[model samples]
Target: MTAKPTLAVVGATGAVGAVLLQILSQRADIWGEIRLIASPRSAGRKLAVRGAEVEVTALSEDAFAGVDVALFEVPDEVAAAWAPVAVARGAVVVDNSAAFRLDPDVPLVVPEVNAHTVRTRPRGIVANPHCTTLTMIVALGALHAEFGLRELVVSSYQAVSGAGRAGVAALRAQLSLVAGTELGTGPGDVRRAVGDDTGPFPEPVALNVVPWAGSLREDGWSSEEMTVRDETRKILGLPRLPVAVTCVRVPVVTTHSLTVHARFQGEVSVDGAREILATAPGVVLCDDPAAGEFPTPADVVGTDPTWVGRVRRALDDPAALELFVCGDNLRKGAALNTAQIAELIAAEPA
Candidate 1:
């Protein structure tokens, strides 16, 4: 029998990192030993896994030694600095940040929609796209293949957790303020009452939605917005595919949801699109308006698959379809997807 593969998780004490470890525990059959790596600040931190405290070690080139798969959830700078070293030390790196998603040699993958790209990682670094894009593509990729997606217009309602633990805190704090918990107001009011809290964001994240995420780059588009356009095009291999996206931060704790409208080259009836989505892998059909069964972040948190609901056809556009999708940003959007990629890569012949 083949020995189980060794795995290392970078940023193992972080929000996504924590979930990644939990996922590995839940999917324990695929792994042998688990190594948790983090920055020096987290080196002494002990993360409890399966009722055992695993000491977090400082991530370095040596951390990758003898590891078969390294899943990174650190900041872009750390992943950018250390992933190559990890690869040099012989580990297949499945990165969860935006660091290499658009890199020419690295493949941007969402396993359900673009698992083939995960296998094309010649440099041993496969990038997980932004959570919003991952959830959108899994739902849209099915329809794109069947009806020929011509154009896509997407708006995202991203959970605070996507920004990491701090983002979640800000939202909770805001809701606390909103509930008049401590200061007779909600969490957003607290931030506003004391200037602003910049833990997860530069500005207050309570009761308000921020249109911007990531740093502002040249041409006035923030990195998050550009990722939606660039990464989606690269993964789809359609640089000219007309796609427009607006990513926003919402008060939801987990599960990044999307409202997508796609115009297909060929006419696709609402029933036809529904049929396709119902049978797609990694996709759960929740589109029942009459029964009030629609996908929502509250309903999809902790779930494995992307959920789609509220399917409708535009009265004026015969070739267009509209739908809402909810996917656990931490699971399918990050950790679980990366883990699935590691499992798939292991299946390939060396």
Candidate 2:
């Protein structure tokens, strides 16, 4: 029998990395060796995986030795610097960072939407899309497949965890401050109570919504908003597809939710779109307003599939449909997608 491939998980101690370890433990074990790697400070830490504990090694060129696949869950700068090193060491890199997502040579992949693009990676790197895009793309891809998507208008209700541990910490701290008090009744009251320590967010995220996520970009668009627009177009192979997005940071601890307005070619039917989303791989349709069943972050957190609901045809435009989608940003948005891509590569003949 052929020997199983060795896999390396970079940033093994991070938030997404933690979830990745859980996913690896839950999924079928196809790896002969799973190496845990993190920053120098996190080295020597042992993390659980596949019913065993693996010690994390510090990030370095030597860590990629004999590894067949390397999954990166580090910051964009870390990935930007080390991914090529992994490639040089003869490892296929599946990076979950914005560093290579838009590189014309590096394929931005969401397995359910564009699995075929994985084989065309000239840089030996596959990029996972931003959490906002991943939160909605699976359902959109399903509809686009049948109806031919033309344009998209999206507004995101992103979880605090999407900003990493710091964001989660900030929200919890602020929530504690405002939990039993009448703080939000007056203007600037929550801000005064939460103080200037908003962690990664611009304003207090608890008991409030900040209409910003990433750094400011050109034309008043945030980096994250543009990310959803650009990554969606790329993943769907629609280079010029019109996409408008507004990303807001919500107090939720996990899972990202988005309201999507997708305009497709020709007339569309609510029944037809519902059927498409209901049967789409990596998607779950939960539309039923009468039963109070629609995708929400609280219900969708900790799940793998993108949960979609509120499926309806636009009243004014027969060519458009509006829907809501939710997905665990840390899972399908990061770890799960990376794991799926690595599995796809692992299944290929060596």
Candidate 3:
């Protein structure tokens, strides 16, 4: 690796890709030449990065040449097919896709938690954790380092944007449809009101909450629920840690919120947890209920740090803690985390 690595941003036309570009522009200039690559349909378009307009190129073997680092934000199938190609052309891939996350050779990293693992990528790829998992892991990673996590019971209130641009468009369309009308939660009230406007969601996201995210699996858990459980364990390096997750689609536009009930080995205290999170990097402690202060999606959107609040020790169990966390699904949850890992690699290349 050279002093200034040549970087490539794959899927540069997508929502997360846009956030990645913004983050790149905000950070120091550690990159030399930045190449933008997207699908054939998005090719010939130009995007402004670091005060320069770079034309998007179609993904091909030539595009990967001379790229020292490739950051990807495409779908699973796309990453599965193209990551090796980028690696074959001698670029280290930091992928924000589910394709290589669970692969044994690919390391799933959150720089705050497992920055050291980025150096051990046998497949020349590092997978970013699920957005929902990234939302809570920064704080939990700090807590777990102190308290030793044993189990987790999480219920996620994910925004429509987690489903990508289509999900956001669907919610906006439904909100427009029900703007002047009375929409109820009764049988098919929302379904009829937003007919054929659910986008990628299973139900209307404007007037109601969908109890599912991702495809249903044979074990009755959605793919998202499984991703949260699996990715959390992997990022924390706790393979046997028991995790139970329930995913729901909320009406919010950008940020994702989670209610985490964590059980740790040994006794835990609220003051200890608060003290740890207060000083932890990439985390903001926002707990103060009497002042009507707690992290919310409306306030946390566009922020890079995970906001943690409503933290308390479980009354029935001294070793358990309950907390609420919120973060921008696109920024910190997806783009920022990947950027952090890539920076780590840039700082110390193999």
lDDT of 2 at 272: 88
Worst 10 residues of 1 by lDDT: 180-189
Candidate scoring better on TM-score of 1 and 3 = 3
Each model's backbone clash number: 8, 0, 0
**C-alpha lDDT values of all predictions:** 0.83, 0.93, 0.93
**Candidate 1 overall lDDT versus native:** 0.83
- Cα TM-score of candidate 3: 0.98
lDDT tens digits by residue: candidate 3, 232-320? 98989999999999999999999999999999998899999999999999999999999999999999999999999999999899999
C-alpha displacement of 209 in model 1, angstroms? 2.4
lDDT of prediction 2: 0.93
Best by the lDDT measure: 3
- Residue 68 C-alpha lDDT in model 3: 92
Ranking by lDDT: 3, 2, 1
Model 2's C-alpha root-mean-square deviation from the true structure amounts to 1.1
Cα-based TM-score, every candidate:
0.93, 0.98, 0.98
lDDT of 1 at 3: 62
What are the RMSD figures for all models against the true structure? 2.6, 1.1, 1.0
